[model samples]
Target: MYDHRKLGRELGLFDTDPLIGAGLPYWLPDGAVVRHSLEDYIRTVERRAGYQHVYSPALGKRALYEISGHWAHYDEDMYPPMDVGGEQVVLRPSLCPHHAVMYRSRSHSYRELPLRMAELGAMYRSELSGVLGGLTRVRCIHLNDAHIFCTLDQVADEAAAALALIGSAYRAMGITDARYRLSLPGAGGKYVAAPDMWARASKILGEVLDRAGVPYEAVEGEAAFYGPKIDIQVGDHAGRESTLSTVQVDFHQPEQFDLHYIGADGARHRPVMVHRSIIGSVERAVAHLIEQHGGAFPAWLAPVQVAVLPISDAQEATAARLRDRCLDADLRVRILSAQDGSLGARVRETRLVPYQFVIGPAEADDDAVAVRLRDGRRLPALPAGDVIARVRALVQAHDTRLWD
Candidate 1:
């Protein structure tokens, strides 16, 4: 098994200081770059998919969640509300309620039936100290969350679209053999969702999956309090199933929040809500990627895609020049010009770096680089421009098979 906590320490991805607290990971530089890459990628996809990104406070008034029904149903898993300055507030554990408030703040027409509001929002969850693990089970999380407000008629299409987005993202990340679970409300559970609404919501989700020919198992009592959900189950490095993504239908929130839009008949009508997350936690996603690809992230996601090692003091100037040029070309490159380390030592230290170049006396004289790949392939001396061009192409195209 590829353990992320072990590798995270060795690779300088993240760290947890007891003084700071448990389940809170401080992202190191290398780890931050990977997360930024993922954030950028997901944001691009969301933009193309017509999601309007927004920002909301991580702390909200207790009355906000109360109005959304989370205070009554999910209060146990939430941080206790505290009085800050004057009024009582709680660190938000989910982004949906905040987003629902945003929707109700505005008046919309039927033309905006499918309003996709998104945010890379921070959330806080109250977890037992023992269960707090690495990025996977953290008390604080940056959630890739969004909520879609649409008419009841648009529910099936939106549900299918969310599922398609999940499938495409997993494919791009090289995650394979992931299964789907259609989670439904059961007779026994702390469900805020009404019984009649539960049956209708579950039936709608079933029809959406059936019409799309997606095979999924309907599990009783696995549904969220708002409604049933379509959960994407991906196996971790240890072969345990983890729910990394979800598409949930919420029939209660809009009603509780009194969200309304002008109908085609020009009357106020309630809109159905679809809560979706392609990746629940950005930190955990990076952790999973590190394990999935064994820390040799695809060129696009690798923090330092290439490192330049000067064979000797004589090659330091040339190495600096090459590194600067790669940087100008927007390529992630590192210059290892420390004379204390030998060529072999530096090379070994950078084994996890996707690509590395050796600047020897001969290569420096020719103004070229002797390229080495993480997969152990050696390439002939290539001009700096060619190296940058190849790497830039791979990054732009999100290509993983660099050697092939």
Candidate 2:
């Protein structure tokens, strides 16, 4: 059984201090590398998919949540409002409200319909102490969140594209074994009192699931307050299920915020708000990934993508040259010297590194280095440039294959 909390500590990925309080674990340097890599990858993917990124304040006016229906529905899970400069402000529990405000900031036209706005933004949740066990549940959340303001007619296609994007991201992250769930409001929760809106949103999401030809379970009371969503669910080591990604169709927020766009007919029309997250939250996603790969991350996501080992002092200069090359190529690399341990021990210590270039006397004399892959595959001495190029290529491609 692989537990992320245990693996996280052992791998020096993250740590929590008593003074800092629970549910607020800070990332170590290596963990930050993993997270930054993931964030950069998401940004690249979002840009390619036509998502315009934005930055928003983590704190919002108390009225903002009230207008978005979050204060009324999700206040229990929210932090208490603080009086800031004679006005009440609180940490935002969701990014959708702020995003709604962004859309309403400027008028839109039919040509800009389906405008995808994305942000790797931070939000807060006042989770209980007991539930705050690791990165899975936390007070501060950095979410890979986005909202698409589209015409009512374009809702289905946008939702479908969001799901497809999530699928592709999961695939690239080596995440399989996740199940789809159509999350609907149950009869008992503090749901919005709009049955017609709920029905429309649920139907659109259901059709998107059907058109995608994927099997999903329709679970009740698992939806957001204002809409229905498709959740990509994954299990932890103890067989506990949690949502990793989601695509939701929301009609209530647009109405709440009075968001509109001018149509081709020159009349104002409501733009549907489609909420989607490729990865629900960076902390939780990294938690699952830590357990999934057991800290042996793929080449592109690996914190130390390459380790250069100098067998002895004789090859220290050679190792330095190789390390510089790796740094120039934008690879996360480290050099383990004989002072750390023997050549074999250094290799074993950095077992999680995707590539290890062993610099020995003969190899240095030949202007080459022997290669050792994480999976125990050893290659003969190859040109240092060729080795660096190969590793750089794999990292760029996000390919898991060590050598080809």
Candidate 3:
């Protein structure tokens, strides 16, 4: 098994300092590059899907989670309410309660039947010290979260649409080795005992999965406190399945929080809410990518896409010019000065970068550079302008390939 923590450390992506506390990741510059790129990609995908982005506070009053039933149902995993100037508050563990409050912030009409709200929310959990493992299990998390408040008649379609969105994202990320689990309330006290609501919501979710042509296994006792959910399990390089994405249909929250919308009849009616996270944790996703691809990220997601190496001090000017050109073309690149390392040493370092180029007297005189790809394929000298344009297109298109 490829251990992401070890790989991440070796790749200089992120670090966890014991002094700062366990499970908190501090992203180095390289890691931030990848993190920012992934967030941008997700935002682009979400905006195109009609999601209205929003930001919510990271902490809330204890009564907030109580209203959402998390305090009662999931207290063990949550930190005890903190005393902030005599007021008891909690470091938010989930984005649902805040989002629910946002939904209740203003009255809504039936026209806003499927009001989808999203956020890059932060959450805190009280994981047992022994149980905390890298990004997968953590105290702090940056959640890629969203909530859809819809009418009962719109729930099924909205559920199906959520599944489609998750499926599209997985496909785009080349995550094909996965399965679905439809989790329902089981024999545990973990779930809220709204039996009638559970039956209705579970049936609706099952129907959505069936209509969407997705295969799923019914898992007992895995549903959230609010409702039933469809959790997608993606396998790592070693085939160990882990939950990656989820679409949770919430029934208890809407009723508990009294979230409603004006119907066509001008009467107040409860709006059902669905909580979905296509990418559960940005930190965990980076960790997963590290292990999945052995830290050799695709061109679009690699921290450093290209490295420019000068053959000798004589080629320093050419390397400098090429570096400027790469930057002007918006390519995430670095130039290897002669003082940095030997040409051979720098070439070996290109394993971390998808593409690398060598500039020397002949090539510089010809206004060209010799290219080397991650796969050890060395190509003939090509014009600097042509190389710049080629890499830019690959980056803009999010191409996985190192070369066109």
Candidate 4:
């Protein structure tokens, strides 16, 4: 099993200090690069899927949660309220209520039956220090969170599309062993108050998953108080399971919030809501990636993709030129020619990085580079253009684990 904390430090990803408080993360420069890349990738996918990006505040009025039913059902997980002027305010624990407010901001028609809104939302939960583990569990989290406002007629199709998006993201991350659990409220389960409504909602979600051909396990009584969900779970190297993504069908919130839209029959109707997160939390995903690859990330996601080395000070200029070329190609490149070391010693150091480009008099004169791939293969000489092209291709493919 991989030691995630050790790997995180060694890779210069993130750290926790006593002064920074527990269950909080301070991302280093390298760690931020990975996080930013992930956000960009997810945002691009969401944009293509018709999601409109929006921002909501971190703090909300206490009554917001009360209206959303979170105050009644999940108050223990929330932070205590503070007096902002005469009114009480609480740090927002979830984004759904805020999204609902946004939905209420404007009138809607059946013509816009499906409206998708996404946010790289920052959320806070009062987690106990004991449960906090590096980036996996933190008080401050950025979620790849989104909400789909759809008519009852459009819910199934929209749900399937959301599932497809999550699957594509997992595949892009090279994780293939993920499992899906179709969560349903139990007849006598924790929050099952209406058995008939629960049965109908469960059947609808099951039919949607079935029609989509999504293999899933039915989990009875595993849903939240408000609704059923489809959870995406993945096991870590230690055989421990974690939820990586979720798609929830909520029937209660819309009614509670009195959200409505004009239908084809010219009547006000409550729209159904679907909540999704392809990567549930940014911090959790980072932690999982650290363990999954054992600190060696793919080229596109690596903090530092290439380290350029010169045999000696005499080759510094040539190495700098190669580094510039790589930078121009938008590759993360590092220079390691400060110390007087043998080429073999330098190569060992370069191993710390995913890719290495070695330049010396012979290759510099030939307008070529000696490439050392991550898998211990050394191409003695290759045209500089060819090497750059290959590296770009590999980066595009997200082949960061190893050259092989």
User: Top lDDT: which candidate number?
Assistant: 2
Local accuracy of candidate 3 as per-residue lDDT tens digits, 1-404: 47887888888888898998988878988889988988888888889889999999999999898889999999998888889999889999899999999899998999987999999879998888886767766889898999999988888988888888877766555555678999888887888887899999999999998998878899988888779999988666556677778898888999999999998898999999988988778977777777777888878888888899988899998888888888898888898888888889888877778889888889989999899998788989999899889989988776677785
Per-model TM-score on C-alpha atoms: 0.93, 0.98, 0.94, 0.93
- Measured by TM-score, the strongest candidate is 2
What does the lDDT read for residue 214 in candidate 2? Answer: 97
Deviation in Å, model 1, residue 284 alpha carbon: 1.9
Q: What is the Å distance of residue 64 in model 3 from its true position?
A: 1.0
TM-score, model 2 to reference: 0.98
Name model 2 segments beyond 4 Å from true. none
lDDT order of candidates, best first? Answer: 2, 1, 3, 4
Report lDDT (CA) for all predictions.
0.86, 0.93, 0.86, 0.84
lDDT of 1 at 244: 83
Pairs that collide, model 2: none
- For candidate 1, write residues 1-404 as lDDT tens digits: 48787887778889999999998989999999989988988899899999999999999999999988888888988999999889999999899989998998889999987999999999999989987778778999999999999999999899889888887777667766677899987775478747788888888888877876877888987888889998877666677677788888888999998889999898999999999998768977877887787788888888898899988888888888888888887889988876658888888888888889888888998888889999899999988788788888878776676665
* TM-score-best of 1 and 2: 2
Q: How close is candidate 4 to the true structure, as a TM-score?
A: 0.93
